[model samples]
Target: MCGIFGYVGDESAGPIVYRGLETLEYRGYDSAGVALRSGGSDELTIEKRAGEVAALSVPTVPDAISAIGHTRWSTHGAPTDENAHPHTGCDDRLAIVHNGIVENYEAAKADLDEHTFTSETDTEVVAHLLERELDSLEESGPDSPPRDGSPGRPDGGTASREGESADAPDSSDVAWRVRRALESVVDRLDGSYAIAAIHERDDCIVATRNESPLVVGHGSNAAFLASDVPALVEHTREVTYLDDGDVAVLTPDSVSIYRDGRRVEPSISTVEWDADAAQKGGYDHYMRKEIHEQPTALRQALGSRVDVDTGTASLDVDFPQGYLESVEEVQFLACGTSAYAGRYAATLFESLADVRATSVTASEYAFTGGRDPWRTLAVAVTQSGETADTLSALREARGAGARTLGVTNTLGSSVTREADDALFIRAGPEIGVAATKTFASQVSTLALLAIAVGRERGTLTAATAREHLEDLTALPGAIQQVLDREEQIRAVATTFADSDAFFFVGRSYGYPVALEGALKLKEISYDHAEGFPAGELKHGPLALVTDETPVLAVLTDGAGRRESLNNVAEVQARGAPTIGVTTAGVDAGSLDVAFEVPDAGVFSPLVANVYFQLFAYHVANEKGRSIDKPRNLAKSVTVE
Candidate 1:
């Protein structure tokens, strides 16, 4: 994870590009840079710093009309001024910013001995290669076409269009040259990358991506390119997601796209989210704000999709006709918090839909074999949709002849495009590296999908479905009740903020929430934490319990509560302090501490999770940890 932003419009480009990069700060980066070019000349100004984007010494380039910015998360080299992005060509005629690795950079650098290298980064090799490519294009006359002789344009049209006189080539022709140069360099590179380059001779930005996520924002007389939607939401919601191997040329008044060296019409879609959703509002951090926003997020995710009157669940997914009915098995693949969400969904599908469901880590799923291919429904759960492992796994599942479904928050993410169908969680933009609202939204959406599948398979009766729908609709209010107890959770957290270790134990659905809570605690507070099923505690984890280690248990109002309470007693007997998260009526009499959530029927886990979120947040805050951007973590896992 890195962040990229580019702008081509009539307004000052530097400030716009800078603001776009600021919006993407959540993605996490070590260095920031911007390249700007004046409209009247080839003069380009580059300002970069090896630190936060705000620390970058951006100059006032009021006349610059085109710009590209990058927030580099170090991959090929150390985070240093010389290794920062916005790398320039040897001749200073081109500036480029890139995301993802170039596996063949060493070989390319071996061939670039004739050119002087200033930085020890793989990205510098790209700038040099593009510089050579552009030189060759200039050597060839304006009328000379690309090596393939396909008119050097995607559409195979001549430089001059119908009704326009065939005249001397101008800046538009330079735009073509830039595009062709990029295409040439793209063919020589190996491995994943998203490159954005602006040449001194043209007021355009040429961009291309292969195995990395990129999107173009279309606005009135302006166009934007970014690695994520939030970077462009402030200016315009209309965006065109670039598929693999697609090249795009953007200018103030136009955006032309190409794939496989042929022109393709871009599908423009509007983002329904308001820009203010990504803002922190008055909250201290985005993580805290999102933790409080879970109620609204769940409400939006459940809005109008389920009908209690009809006793049916309607999920916005496009499956082949009769696909859900014919499915024999289900496999959910995801990573990190999404994996936990998938784990919970797998249980829901198994119990509600009466299907064989399993959850697997996306990175490891390619090696596991039990897939029935045509009979298996492979579901990928990813909040960002651009997760590299999930996308790769989805493709692998497709190659194995399994139909795939993507559950994602990002509409145009690679997973959404690659999978056969997409189910959007509609969590809007989650800016914190530690996921909050998206996690809640994902689990809620998955529950709805399970209900829909149950109805299709005749496993869940209409009356039962109606009852579950009512429980689902009440989740938002239940989460609000939990949020209302923030002060109580904060007090509990302060009591254990100095604990050296934490243990979370739960049964069934609560098990996944326990795991997620431990993960959040470790991520933000830098504490050693482990979450395991309550039944497994006596197997080994009990040995780690001590007075200094607090054991947190989730025992909702259900059949599993008694056994979970027994496990809590075992931990308490080991001299470990205990904290129980349960429904209001449960008597957690033997626990050192207890947090009560509303009795939300089968959906009480959703409410209990909110209590854990607040507990983790306050723990991190009390420890003086960086709660928003945790060290060594990025919001989106774009690379394997």
Candidate 2:
């Protein structure tokens, strides 16, 4: 996954592109670059670096009105200056920035033996191929095939050319030539891509996407292109989501869209989030800011969805009156943190909605399948809504005739558009690579979703629903109590900073929280952490425990509390230090380290999770690890 930002505007483009890249830093990239060219100038200036966006020095280009920037995650080559983006053509007249992979790049490269390449990247081949395509268009008319044995002519065998002579090409043909060249280049590309191009002779920016995300920001005097909404949300909230095979030509005043060489109308949608939500504010790191914002995020998710007095939930999505009642089972498909959240929701669905619910990891779901599609309700849980594997799984479920619902934070993400129905979690822009507030918000929304389903199925009485909603309403204050004990959590983290590994054990609803706690530790602290059901510790994991290992257990006043405490006793008997996250009924003297949470019935895990988050954050801080941008992890998995 990478970030792309481009601008065609009246003011200088350097600062806008730079700030946009900063917003996308959480997407995880190793290299940064920017290509700037003034409206009337024929020369392009390129600056790049192999580190973070802040490391890339941008020269003052006062007159530059159009530019494109990229933050690249190492894919084709290692992070090096030569491998950075904004790659140029052999003639040095055109520059291209791209995200996603080109599967046929080697074949494209083999044909350009005469041309010299500077970078060891698949993207460089496209730049050279574009140059060759332009050369062919300039030498021969649009009807002639490429002499380099590239892909053949366009599908219709080229345009009429309006009777223009093949021997001589006019200046007016340059725009047409660029368009045709891009078409030919895309035809040869076999994999996913989102590409933006700029030529010295043209003042406009051209972009296209296939199996990758590309959006356009529509402004009064400018139009911009970016890989995601946050990049350009500050400048304009109105955006056009580009579909596969769509080409957009953007100038200062207009954006003309074309699909398969035919002009098409654009679908413009408005984004509600302000740019301020994406900022770190006064917090030291974006992750910390998000951790503290969990209360507000939870409130936002439950605002209009819950009826506090009546103890009922109303999901703000299109659902046929009896559709939910007819569902015999519920299947959840997701990846990573979202998958963990789905696991938590699955437990609630089985108990509250009285349905068989199971969470399947999105990538592995296709290989293992035995379900009655007609009676199963498939739910896709994702934060960005653009996760590749989750999207694929949702499509597969739909093809099997299962009703699909997308539970996502982003409004216009691919999952929202492709699924049969959508339930938005309303957790505004989350910029941290390691999810925090969004996790809290997702679980809260799923709780409400379970309540709504139960109410429709007549499985949950009004009094039971009231109790659940009351617990949900108190989650914010309960989590705040945990955040207020940050210094205490820091002390605990400092004590366990020397541990080699961590083992987290829980049961029932606490099981998913245990998994998520371990995930947070592994993600931010770079520690080897494993989560398992409490009863399974003796099965295999208990043998790995040593005095140097820290055992963290989630035990509350619930059905599994006794079994969880037995597991904790088993760990303590092995001389390992035990840390228990529990409610009031569980005594603090029972464990070596006790992190207490307020008693909230089945919702106790929500409060218990906050302590684990704070503990992980402090531990990562103690270890001097990168808190926000962990190595080899991206915020959104746009690529499979």
Best by lDDT: 1
Taking the tens digit of each residue's C-alpha lDDT, what string does model 2 give over 614-639?
88898999999888889888788877
Specify the poorest-scoring 10-residue window by lDDT in model 1.
161-170
The TM-scores, one per candidate, come to 0.95, 0.93
Model 1 gets an lDDT of 0.87
Instruction: Give per-residue CA lDDT, model 1, range 268-354, as digits (tens).
Output: 999998789879899999999999998889888999898999889887777777877889889999999999999989988998999
lDDT of each: 0.87, 0.85
**Model 2 segments more than 4 A misplaced:** 140-176, 367-370
Candidate closest to the true structure, highest TM-score: 1
Off by over 4 Å in 1: 145-171, 367-370
Q: Please give the RMSD to the true structure for each candidate, in Å.
A: 2.9, 3.8
Error of 1 at 426 (Å): 1.4
Name the lDDT of candidate 2: 0.85
